[model samples]
Target: MAQQALPVRTARLGRALGPEPTSVSGVVLLLPGGEESSVRRPSPMMATASVRALGRRLARTGRADGLVAHVVHYRYRGWNGGEAHLAQDASWAADEAVRRYGDVTVCLLGYDMGARAALRSAGHEAVNSVVALAPWLPEQDVATPAEPVRQLAGRRVLIVHGTNDERNDPELSFRLAARAKKANRDVCRFEVHSDGHALYQHRHEVHALTEDFVLGALCGRGFSRPVEDALQAPPPLGLRMPLATGFGRSLRR
Candidate 1:
């Protein structure tokens, strides 16, 4: 039988994450990479694609007892505001996720510009974990996030970036992850030998990893799979990575 194309439901994104927690106890918010021109609009197709693949890979985690997995479409950050725009969007998404989902945990999944946006959203209270795919962080390049996220000290962040990212050096992802770790002990980075700036080359591997990690979070260490295996990255340097305090040290904001 032919598989049905996942339906694209246009749902409002602001306020109330809605009420009701699925068995998995979480949801994924897909944000757009920043807008540089008319070209920077949110890619519903790509967002949907990520959600489709991730939602399936995440199936065993939430669906064990028929839990519903919602793939959210975050508000678009139309030109201007740079990192600050991303930072604010992230917070709004978190607030909305909690309101709608109530007590369920929230895991943010963002790529490219969206990835940076997801990272900014990390400091919010309800976000249990963040899946930052090729994210940019707050630093000289971008301003420190709004007061709230800047204060997040214990949130969990996961970063995945390809060795061949076109827009920026892939090393940027590691740097951001390192900054996040320095910011909070729970951050980790996974480097994938993916192609281009897209998620085309390593679908199955990525999907498997997402399934394991997200499940591991909600199940609270009871996942059949070991968390060590899920990371699939270099050994975490334990929590003392030097913060990026130089190179572009700004005098004032």
Candidate 2:
């Protein structure tokens, strides 16, 4: 059955919902990046082609049952790293999703600042996993009451950053993964070589990894065998990058 985009509402929050099915397998809260000035003029989440594409993919290829997806539009457009304005919006959306869907497992997918918000908010009760794509991490020290890399201790987390990205250094994402690992948190890092922040060069790979994680979390199967094996084998546990380039570039400039 072809899934259709439908409207899912919350009393006073922003709009949410993507291709939904009759029986929802799980819920994903999708967020996009924005500037502080956007607080007065937030962008519509559903309008983002990349975000909708991911939602559609989940709706189509997820297990036997489809997934419920929500793209969040922040009440405030900016990240407000010190205050976590965006994470609060995500929390509201997650709460509404839980209220409407009942105790289902929830996954979060976000990009740039949105990724920061998702990671900050992953400690919530309903979230089981998080996928942060090209997340913007400057100096890697931004933490609000809503976040700390340690907050995600028991949840599955994936951080995919492009090595060539000039906007946000991939090293920040790596540092985040390292911090989580040091604390014994479940975390995976995929450093995409030759790609930029948008991950345009490896969008398909990003989608596959995200889909696998979401499906695994929802079905109670955990990560796939290849991922499991990789995670258990070495230093960069579950790190996915092109096999051709050996570690891509030096960790330093």
Every model's TM-score? 0.68, 0.80
lDDT of 2 at 21: 70
Clash pairs (backbone) in predicted model 2? 39-77
Q: Which stretches of candidate 2 lie over 4 Å from their true place?
A: 1-19, 36-38, 45-47, 140-147, 237-253
lDDT, candidates in the order shown: 0.53, 0.69
Question: In model 1, where do residues sit more than 4 Å from their true spots?
Answer: 1-11, 14-24, 32-34, 37-43, 59-61, 65-68, 77-79, 136-152, 221-253
- Return the top candidate by TM-score: 2
Report each candidate's C-alpha RMSD, comma-separated, in the order given.
11.9, 9.0
Give one digit per residue, the lDDT tens place, for model 2 in 139-250: 7234523136776878888788888999987877876777777665467777777889888877777777677677777656566554455455444655553422322122
Superposed on all Cα atoms, model 1 deviates from the true structure by an RMSD in Å of 11.9
- 175 Cα displacement, candidate 1 (Å): 1.3
Q: Give the per-residue Cα lDDT of candidate 1 at 182.
A: 53
